[model samples]
Target: MTSSPVPDTPVEVIVDLLTKAQDIASYCDNMISDLFLAGQTLKMLIHMSQAKRVLEIGMFTGYGALSMAEALPEDGCLVACELEPYLKEFAQPIFDKSPHGKKINVKTGNAMETLKELATAGEQFDMVFIDADKNNYINYYKFIMDNNMLRLRGVICIDNSLFKARVYLNETTDSNGLALREFNQFVSNDPRVEQVIPLRDGLTLIRRVPPCKITDDEVFRGVTGRFILDRMRLDGKVAYVTGAGQGIGRAFAHALGEAGAKVAVVDLDGAKAETVVEELFLKGINAISITADISKSDDVQRMIDAIVSKWGVIHIGCNNAGINMNSASEDTSLEEWDKTFNVNLRGTFMCCQAAGRVMLKQGYGKIINTASMASLIVPHPQKQLSYNTSKAGVVKLTQTLGTEWADRGVRVNCISPGIVDTPLIHSESLRPLVQRWLSDIPAGRLAQVTDLQAAVVYLASDASDYMTGHNLVIEGGQSLW
Candidate 1:
């Protein structure tokens, strides 16, 4: 059986310890076989399953046990069993030296007896690794099934089922080989679990199937329709909203908070962010505030880091921090143009990139960028050339990332809002300009901050699971005029 190499530092250390133990076991002729699993393989299995409680039938020298334990979370536990008392004694010292040693509980006794005791205690495990006596493989399988020791949909991994390639030999008299051959067939015929993977050394992975409750009639009715409102609910989800201090971004923070998300209000103005977060708390929503300049990469990274350090994962990101500048196309200074792009385009890119990393690793995320209706059509009376161009670039940036990350489980979309009744549009210098643009809007009124809230919630929820790479236009027929 070929072994996969482990390159990680922790796995490498375990491999070293296993090699030393293998030499000792061979020199002593203790009949303690060095049929230990590859460190990388065991770690991968534990991590992929997110196994909190693991049961290892054969502890051996603790290499596999240590590897699995190290992959678990701080509160996770591993119960290990070994037939030889000396093997536990030999491995305990090594485990003691590792920080993850506390997670491993080594039990020395007859594995069958230990299994029976665990079953009687009603203990369940997320995963069970069997690498003990080959002859009793089938018996261990039956015990786990009969006692309900494994949780539903849990994993059962059997190692060394090939018996050194002797299982394929029909005339082999080896008792272990014959037993393994019989065990493989027994598991194959069992309908409760589906034999999933066959890896090195005849390693077999069996996943217990949960009972199917949905019927053909349910399928015809479209099961998703029943939970339409529930699907939109973001209970227990964590959301980060940039520029949440005031204006449209503040409205988004409130909307997400009301929809059951724990909101992180991020703004360059630390006081403003905290004020908004305090208001959210008074409204019975969980919230926090973070100060960061999105244009600076270090600040943006720190913002994401702080949120993840506190919440463990980021489910939604709203890249809304931006600046606006109104200047004639010919009279716009370089500094004015650069500052607009820095916050509007560069800042948005940095936030998306940072949040994208977290989302890609989690395999599920939603990112909504704030584009402007000026992206579709330049404002008639406004002379903000830089603002219009920067927003247009945002639309294309969203489309590019949306297409690239859709398959990776993260959806990127942008919202282009029309003239909104915010401080940004009601400034003393823009009052005349604002009134002139209102005549062009068929709705006859500037958009309210609340008008954009529903659209943001819809894009953030699972109700938009099938949508991506599309700019959701919230303008009230102004672009048409």
Candidate 2:
């Protein structure tokens, strides 16, 4: 059995320290060390008694620094490097209030250069916390070790070593994922480090071994627009999308067309419909474009007809269009209220009704609706009464239709996106509110378009055949609040 935690420190002391650490880390000005975990403080402290001098490389709000500083003896000292002056200024008071404040020194500037300077000054540490720079994690570790910043028995803690657990998978493509994968392998084989912790994102705890170095062998390296189209076949299949003239809609149309489904690109602008169709024809996706207000029936009907006349069937329908007014109930206008629902809600229902009929006959089809986390929770700093209400309606609609069409083979589902970095979001209405709502997002930023692709692919593929009427909330746990 594994040995128990040290009995010298009271559990309550650890809990209080961690609580303060979390509060300080959560400060808005410091996004650098935003990935630090409070729980890791307890483990880090257990290994900290051996060190009289501790250095924390990334001191975002001073959470990691504070936690490690508190564990140091009266003669022990901590040097924390924070690049942002505002963050340093903001966090200084928090540290000043701490009992170990006198023992901690806050340094400001580029962490790589600062750490190098400290090494040049013969500054060594018994413990170090490396929690910055995803793209430079491997390089940073090498620099810290090459300069002998850590004594042979010194302990080093690296946070975000997992990069959202993406590195463990095979399909990782982003820089963060690639860098983490490389770092993990480097640490795993580096004779200098004994163990690594695969915590939340990831954390590695390594004890310095003299004459050992992190080698290069471990060094690893790692848009839309809308438009028109025409359906080629429907024999018994149907497909539809909102905002189809540009961005993700155009991408989805090409994908579905290549698969042989008669696809419809639904857009508010008629000209966009024609343009999208032309692009699809060039790619051979059997696609067409229809200009219709998603919220209005007559408009949707014209587009629906284009698909029916060409393919004689409807199978896949996508509710992918939405708008944001960015107004609270008091500030929101009746026009904004009606307009948002008209497109996201009324339009979704109109398309569902038209496609539901065809699917009821065929007894097999798929309907994918796009919902938003604004529907599930009240997002802060950025308020959009109309947008939130409309998306909420889409969720209930999906569930209701899913129940009605389950036996009919028509799977109805919704993809609830968090704040996606889309053109619409970048529109005049949303840009002002981005920075306000960003801090609330668990993922630390707006959702990327690529982030939504997999969720859509999953819902559209046969892999989700057995799944129906499910509201797939993909907002990066924003609703967890």
Candidate 3:
């Protein structure tokens, strides 16, 4: 598997910037908005550190407004314009509570009219963000320019430029798309502003100048999305990985252990258990082996008991052990169906039940369940009715339990992967036929174990704390239909 991203100064610097922003937001007593905007602001601050004065043309509940203001230098100032009169009362409480309230001016009234007045008032800003009135995007940009409020080298960000792919269609059109299309073309030929990078929705980054040149830095700057996956790691957490013996299980055990998690390497095979422990030891992560079939109630209870006895608490529990059987529904005897469910579904139930009890007590936990893409949509060429049905059960089980326990702090989520290139699929007897079956996949290939690793880590980490009761389908978009 590939190594995790290297720790870098950029990441830390962004973190520090967010720390200050969060402090400001918290100080203002708008912790909710601060908490919500923290991630987004940290990402934006990473792009342009030299940014000072900022103008946010729309301040709804003061989230984006306060976030940008918190990132600016102490000498920097931010101006926010809100069209609604009562928003000041709604957002004022948070700003008044914030220590950096002095740095921001929230102007109440129609955004366009207020922006027009800012131009008349001879106000200039180094950075401007326009996220108001979708149909009036072009109008907002023109007004900002005609007033000469944008300084040379200043950047203007226009949000929601994509309109959820609606703008790209030639038919079933919208006035919003029409206006956005005109704005995109107008900016393309305009003597001022360079670079437009579409994020979710879209983010157009424009640098003001005569015959504006799109610098490599600006191009890179517009790719402002936080590598969200990079945020998952045990930097200072603990994890328990089941079936942590051979194959993909061992890989996951080693990965989490190497990433600083104190791993509980578990398996039904005693020798394999010890082998994983040795591997984790070599990697310098604290580890212990427990030989137990995860599906057994007695075994799961002992595992949990051992874990709590040693570590005092569990942070992440990965329910990942599963077996496969290939048989037509007619040929698949009741015995075989029971055997499949015994390990896949029943085992998952036992483990989650045991882990859920502990996690519920702790009041904060992440349980990452492995549910194959078979749970989302069935593969066309094969029929493993029992396996597919069991996996689907796991998906709903996660969702149901997640909802039941959400208010208590334990978040349960599942990952559904498409045909993964595991040892199970690569067996000498099966590889040839499996390769032929892979042709039906639009990605033209099977997924790698490493492909599932990130999703597992995210579901088990703080990055996905607010997410639960969801099946994160990672099947190369195979189930798109």
Candidate 4:
């Protein structure tokens, strides 16, 4: 939802700074340590560690200094020490162009005297970078440790530790190479945690050893972890699905049974419900069938009683049975309006109340209602005032029961699905209506019954324990348009 941050300058200034630094190195009489990617590396380290106060012992062309400063917070500071005064003036022009230039304080003098001055000033740093003369590497590290100049969680980085691999191979008699070899040995035996990365010319990262270090046996003492996949499993649960004869209800029943719950398929058509139960049996799932019309209050109560008698408990109640009658607003009959509400909204409420009693007594249950995308947006090219209003009422009813039952160990939530490709919509008369709907759907297609399987399982599982009073809309971005 948020846009990428714009650069504080007119151009990609970091790349520009590196380009200018590389050009200056080519024309200069003195050699600058511009070979390694120290600028970007230090910048990444500063951002990761959130280092507010940085100490850069040697900043050649001010490229690394400016990079570190850029990563710092607005009020952060970086102290750049150097042995020569002329190099400060050479890099100052580039620094002045940067917004972070104010964060850098260039100290021109002998490096050791500047370190002593900072120590006496009662200063501490979150990060310390040492890339100066190799001969004084040990002395700089020693001063930092002995004076307590580094914070307890501070990081100290040493560049060029391998010294062109000469320290490890011992192939050179050069003074800088020999000094680096000794410094590497000293750090290897020190009481700290360190890692040497072969990033260009050996970058060594060191941090203070943590006290009370973690042990293998203590990793999971008196505790266990069930990861996301395990938490999603609905093992040892009992579930019953209304209108499980076919379509979305059939899918929800099969999904719940496949997830290790004993399932009962309820429907007004006894033969169709038995057929679906037979399909579940072929898949080695334990299931039963019950005939009941949810629109009747007695039938709804009988449906819940039948499930509890078979499984001894009901853990999941899926109220997915509903009907829609398409008609013009003015031409819609009172019979059609009442019929839609009786089955869609009133039946759903009856099922919720009956199942909610058993769940409240047992201290746990999940009820999932099947609402429609029509509850959110008016379906174009067709008018079904009663159907749309009933579905909207379903959503409101779900929110009310969800909040009321949440504290009593019963969770209620609704799913609003887009137009689905089913046998009911596979007619010649509805072909033009389907085409008009596809244009409104951003995905350019209708949702399949299988497409909504995971959503039902998520609501029925322990994974959605923290969620309540929610309307989960799965409309393929149709409602947005």
TM-score of each: 0.55, 0.49, 0.53, 0.55
lDDT of 2 by residue, 162-272 (tens): 777788779878888898899888878887667656765576778865443334232211001111111222323457777878766666666566655667888888799
The per-prediction CA RMSD against the true structure, in angstroms, equals 16.8, 21.2, 20.7, 16.0
The 0-to-1 C-alpha lDDT of every candidate, in the order given, reads 0.88, 0.73, 0.77, 0.85
Compose the digit string of candidate 3's lDDT tens values, residues 342-383: 888999989888889988988988888888889877765556
How do the candidates rank by lDDT, highest first? 1, 4, 3, 2
Taking the tens digit of each residue's C-alpha lDDT, what string does model 4 give over 129-245?
A: 998999999999889877888886688899888888888765688888899888878887777545456466777887754434355342322113454655777889999999899
Which pairs, if any, clash in model 1? none
RMSD of model 3 against the true structure: 20.7
Counted clashes in each candidate structure: 0, 25, 4, 0
Query: How much does candidate 4 score in TM-score?
Result: 0.55
Model 2 root-mean-square deviation: 21.2
Cα deviation of 120, candidate 2, in Å:
42
What tens-digit string does per-residue lDDT give for candidate 1 at 34-57?
333465588899999989999999
The list of candidate 1 runs beyond 4 A from truth reads 1-226
Q: What TM-score does candidate 3 get on C-alpha atoms? A: 0.53
Better of 1 and 2 by lDDT: 1
Candidate 3: give the clashing pairs: 27-97, 28-97, 28-98, 295-347
Candidates 1 and 3 compared: the better one by lDDT is: 1
